[model samples]
Target chain A: MTQQPAKKLYIHDVCVRDGFQMESVFVPTDAKVDLINRLSLTGLAKIEVTSFSSPKAIPALADAESVLVNLNRVPTVEYTALIPNARGCERALKCELDEHNVVMSASETHNRANLRMTRDQSLAQFAEIVRLTNGTVAVNASLSTAFGCPFDGQICDDDLLANIDRIAEIGIKRLTLCDTTGMANPAQVRRICELVLTRFPELTVTAHFHNTRGMGLANCIAALEGGITRFDASLAGLGGCPFAPGASGNACTEDMVHMFNAMGYDTGIDVANLIPLANEIPSLVGHDVPGQVMKAGSYDRIYPMPDWLGGKEQTRLAGSGNALIDPECRVTEVAK
Target chain B: MTQQPAKKLYIHDVCVRDGFQMESVFVPTDAKVDLINRLSLTGLAKIEVTSFSSPKAIPALADAESVLVNLNRVPTVEYTALIPNARGCERALKCELDEHNVVMSASETHNRANLRMTRDQSLAQFAEIVRLTNGTVAVNASLSTAFGCPFDGQICDDDLLANIDRIAEIGIKRLTLCDTTGMANPAQVRRICELVLTRFPELTVTAHFHNTRGMGLANCIAALEGGITRFDASLAGLGGCPFAPGASGNACTEDMVHMFNAMGYDTGIDVANLIPLANEIPSLVGHDVPGQVMKAGSYDRIYPMPDWLGGKEQTRLAGSGNALIDPECRVTEVAK
Candidate 1:
């Protein structure tokens, strides 16, 4: 076997902000705070505690401010919140967030459709948010539909690069290429990630993917292969686009961590610690979550021998015996 | 974007055999034959229609002979079946199958636990089956637990290579490395596939993966990158190890095709044609299958704008407008 890579992978949880925002039922402030606190103990590199979205705009996350204020902050884990505009940034600043995550779309049509503003206006708003922060907190711009736009289909590479250039020029040192509607194939993910990294070596690039078409984990793997170490995922695979019909959730946090840890990367978080917390998400959201590791356990989980095999010892003994009546022989008997 | 590769990928559907065997409800023989016939028109390279095991052993597929006789076989597609031993090989030969797929496990504990035979016994059985067929039909040997054995944990490379050497020595030209319990991680998959190809250049290495832990599509990509083109997938992602509790089905066929086609590889199978067929599986199996593309639609599926956004035309008009009274203003109003 090849030696396991020694690189450390950073996992950022956005279950509360990005995930909860799409839920039809309101996730209570206590539940949100409790979930964040539980996740804090799981050794994640970062947690997007909640969003600073307007209550009227995203009523599901209306408890964002309350969740932030009530959550017990972890010193080692950077706590961040989504800042949609100047007002959201101002609210986030008071809550002492370590990072302000601003959003826009690479596609002009998607930018208008999602944020109700032109791409230029969203960029201007981002610049104002950076100016408002005044270096008090780090700002990360999440370029939604950077991989592909649901409205415009595939976004042109030149347009994507140019948008990143504008975001970087506004003093943002971090950028997240969001597969907003899960249109990214692995080849596209690897190619764009490679170009972005080569073009902006100083910026920290993170991949945010949705498992809408079952390509979420695969896309994340491709991004990693293309040299991205930071990823944005949701606990219990809890996020999806409100406008995208029949879509599943985000790249599941526990599932992603489990795969990485198994592949010999140091994710710093044990997936065993995350599964229990993930299991509770169904009760919190009042629906089943799309996480597999929580349901199947980790790959290391050993299942007991089937009862029809008459236990392992019997099977082991019968395996070498020529006896025709043993459980080993039963397969032939049943077949006949 | 990279130029799409011209390499042809062979997708083998095992839903009727591997998938149906795991179902609690025995899909009627007519249903099995109908599903296989529908899948045949989708440009798949091969279909494992059913297994020739003793009917009593797998009651769900007790009508294997009936299914083969009743279904209208496609001219271009290769029809194959699982042949457990001499009896199965005889049954498969009488049906005039294009290929006979035999099986064993690389790990001894798993071999005994699953097939009620030691590794040696399983290999001997494979040799006997090959002798019984006498080169009349193609013989492919599927190595279950080749990636990792749930009972024994990771199988040693030396042991795995030795088993493959024996199978190849026994005149098995086509071999499938199966992650029977979904324990194979991507790094391990890539490494093993590379080693197998380099060592056994004569054998046609196919990857058989399960999405038990949500790494199905990712592992398939890794295997592809490792230079294996043939894949074993199930429609609607049906089929899981009956002994592995909470295990998910096989790598989803449509989803796999969707990813490969999107990545510029020619999978031959059109995902759009397969989706409608995949939609029928849940009703037939009496449970929701773990297929994402069938549920979420393909990545190209464009969702209509939310009703609150007025419509695409209105959004396009409001996108450049400075007017605050348009639907664009609703986000701010609602937030307030």
Candidate 2:
């Protein structure tokens, strides 16, 4: 039997920042701190702690500074924060974040709606943010709407490449092509990532996807096949854009970790341990969470067989069962 | 750019039988009729309406005969039912089902527990069912646990092939290799489907997968790449073994239809229409369902921009409009 070559994939968890921001309820600062500390112990390469945004804009993440300051960061886990502008960058720098993420949408309509700026202006702002930080933090410029945009039907590959080239010129070494509205197909994912990797070999391109269209994992696989080794996932599939109608949750961290680990790839995250943290979200927020893995549990957690069945082979089980039963015999009585 | 030739893949919706049977609430016979009727209009080539099991065993699908009799079958739709034994075959024959499905788990433990028989006994029962049905219904035998089994890990390919060969000798025209517990990896799925399709060119091999490990879609893609086209998906990711511990849901019907349609492969299913039906299941079952697309809705649903916000070129003019402000200076907020 031939085995596929093993690959190392970096998992950047965004459950606290991206995941919590989308929820209606504001998670308490202490809870956020606890959640971040819990996630740090799970062997994640990076944990996106919070966003440095105005309190009035995203009230849910208003306690970003307190949350960041309170987090018990693991030595090996890199803690990052989302910085939308120079002001946000300054706020993030105050927290001494190891990395800061600045995003620009590829689609002009989404750019205008999401960031209230054109693509070029967003790029310029990102460049300014990078300069203001003075290399204090590693800046990851995320190209949102790289696949297809919710506002616009389809995004052109050339437009996406042009943006990547511009970001690369701004001295951003790390980049992420985000499917903000989850409109990306695997073919589109492969094409976009391949083009970027081929053009900017030195740069590391990460993929951030939503399960809105149910192709999140497929797109991840396509990106992996196209030479991308970094990805952003929300714990238990948390996070959704309030502005993007019909947008589902982000790719579940547990699900992604499960896929990578099963496929002979190392994600450096313990999927089983992540479940409890994932399940805590719905209670933290006042609504039902979108994640499936937390509710369903991992594949290894088995239900106990009936005790009444005893030593005799259990028969007439609905699906797959363990006990042996005689094929020819008919058992009329139900086990009490 | 060269386009890959579109593969012709088939989808067999098993929601009525496999899906509803696992549910705690008994879906009314009229509702089952309505659900199957809606699915038939959605371009499904095949639909498994019910299973010919004893009413005492599976009370949820006890109305199998009534459900089949009431279905508004469209032309080209192959309505099938699961026949567990010779008695079930007789019941299926009486229902006048277009096709009768005989299932046997490849793992001895699963086979014994699920069917109350050993491997050989199950095969003998399948043979008897096949002989007794005598073309009244097309016989399609499903080999469960073809991948890894929970009880017995890592089922060998030769074991599955031997079963396939035995079923072939009994003149079963169609065979489905089921990942009963969702234990299949892509390479394993490809290898088994490739072997089955190559060795039994006359038999129509279909792949049934569970999303227990999140590799359901990947495994399906691998099977398609390996030349096995037919697949089984449950609407809204329904169906799990109540007896099998840790088993969750089947591969979502809406998710699968969305992928196939996006990939330009025709499964003869309308994802747009099917999505609504998928969404309806949660309410019918009185719980939040596992499938994401149904809850999130499709990617095309448009979100209305705030009236307070100016057009795409509008510059922010209010308190904390800064968050919505684009990084690009293409649009500037004018004092209003």
Candidate 3:
């Protein structure tokens, strides 16, 4: 009978990693470490600290090693790092991170365009990374373009399930189904998530969605309905996809928390503390970010009563000390 | 099992009336009539054209009668007008509007502030208006501040239900529960909507939400889940409350329809045709509006297929026209 089924939803904050990866402006390593360190205290279930990609390729997160080594990890929080390839895993293993999050797009074309490898090649690389960190860390695979691909059109169900089937074969029990490029709708998300979960009941399902088409929160709600309990969100809705500039980026950490919390679903992340972090985003990224609740505030946050309503009109007495003309409110006295 | 429970969900667009009323600059009568005329053809269930309030009081919608008279009403569309008093009803009767939408706030304080009448007085006046236009037009009452009042913190459930009970007693068959300041939350919306519908099974319930706190679409989806069918949305997310300027206004018509359509619910409205109308709003209003899908295209709207993917990589061959992928996918050609 409950509308909100996720009584204690697990929120994964990805601002420092996936979000910063999109920023054209390179946030300093010290700033990244400081922000992640601050975010670690915000009651989030997980935080993806950084990506160990080649500095020549992505200079923004080039200092992944330094950020990871310097992080003041929270005891209750799981700290994961994005390992794009076996080399990235080698680099992250030195940092002694909590886990490794390997990513491969479900679409063969997107895989080739983004990772410079075919789907098969990417899966082999992921398997290599998974093998490298088999017992060293809790490794998980993120199936990007699980809903739709930018380079290609709608990802076929068999093609997507095949990728999930392949990753499951590699003993990767945890999976993050990503709507890369924000092309996911609710019905599509529900169908896909339901399909994945129903097939692999043992897999820990995490939904990573973008607000690309402005359905981030709505999609999140849908995914939750599809029995997804874990979410990946960015601070201040940062990490807007480089492809669709000025559009929705990652599902906003605070906005999602706000929505879930408002819906009576308990996501233990500190939504109030994240607002300050979301506020610092415009300055960090050097432009306005796309997060809504940060600017609009929490549903319970009361806006000041309008001046015109309180001043000349003595009907509602926040301004007036006037006694009620009719206690039952059947009639009202004329304004003095 | 069906994701789309509400097939042919009724969409009631309130752009011309509620939307324009918030504008600082006066939108001309011809423009209002033209927009309504265009909206009439968009397959919406209802359109609230204009409010029949005093022209001097609200200069923005001063020519309500002119706009109403000039409108080329589509046979399939229901045109309604907001009537503040019996005098406004008298004015609307002259134009022969399809329905009369009389509004009264659930919050006594808000009732005084916005309409300059106490809750009881507004109800009494609305009842009088209903009596005047009883058989001439369909009389529906809009209960503003049904969720929360800016001056008043949270409207109690009993008080809101009491107001609903009073209006139903007056023989009004249709009711709109409005989030006047966008203070409605999903759980609260569901609870109240369930209560009202359960108490009065025969009454048609329409939910009017604002995106002030960015919960507009989320709220709409919740209402749909709660078995409420009819909705009030404004074009281009227009009609921001005058009290809280620049924040979300009424739920954008296209955004809601887009979400519904995306979720496989049938709104019976042609969503594609409404985009042009949404696009024209920024120019007409002289300011930017808050609607998202208008800015971010529909979910399936493919973004140029990421040129680099098809160019150097040649993985997804749009330029080469490689004979259609899988034939089942309507494209062919394996990656080199």
Local distance difference test values of all predictions, in order: 0.84, 0.76, 0.80
For candidate 3, the TM-score of chain A alone relative to the native chain A: 0.90
Error of 3 at B15 (Å): 2.3
lDDT of 3 by residue, B1-336 (tens): 623344768999998888898788888888888888899898899999888899888788888878877889888999998999989988888889889999999987778878888888988887898789868899999999888776665777778889999999999999999998876777777777887889889898999998776678778877877788899999988887655544568898998898787666778876778989998998888987777677666655543345555554544444322132344652111110
Give the winner by DockQ: 2 or 3: 3
Ranking by DockQ: 1, 3, 2
Best by lDDT: 1
Residue A260 of model 3, lDDT score: 79
Full candidate order by lDDT, most accurate first: 1, 3, 2
RMSD of each: 8.3, 8.2, 6.5
What's the TM-score of every candidate structure? Answer: 0.91, 0.87, 0.89
Q: On TM-score, who's better, 2 or 3?
A: 3
Steric clash pairs (candidate 1): A56-B334, A334-B56, A335-B54
lDDT per residue for candidate 1 within B1-336, as digits (tens), equals: 754446788999999889998777889888888889999999999999998888788888888889999989989899999988777888778899999999999877678876788878888888898888888899999999988766555677787899999999998999999999898888888888998999999999899999989899999998997889999999988888654456568999999998888777778887989999999999998988888888777666554455665555544433321231223211110000
Off by over 4 Å in 3: A1-6, A242-245, A303-336, B1-6, B242-246, B303-336
Task: List model 3 lDDT by residue over A111-147, tens digit each.
Answer: 8777888888878987898778878799889988888
Candidate number with the higher lDDT (1 or 3): 1
Q: Backbone clashes in each candidate structure, one number apiece?
A: 3, 12, 4
Please report the interface RMSD of model 3 to 1 decimal.
9.5
The clash number for model 3 is: 4
Instruction: List, residue by residue over B1-336, the lDDT tens digit for candidate 2.
Output: 855556666788998889888778999999999999989888887999999999989999999889988888888889999998889988778787788899999877678767777889988888898889877779999899887655554566677778888999999999988988876666667666787888999998889998776667777777776787789999988887553434347888888877776666766676778878988888788766567667655544444344534433333323221233334421221110
Error of 3 at A212 (Å): 2.4
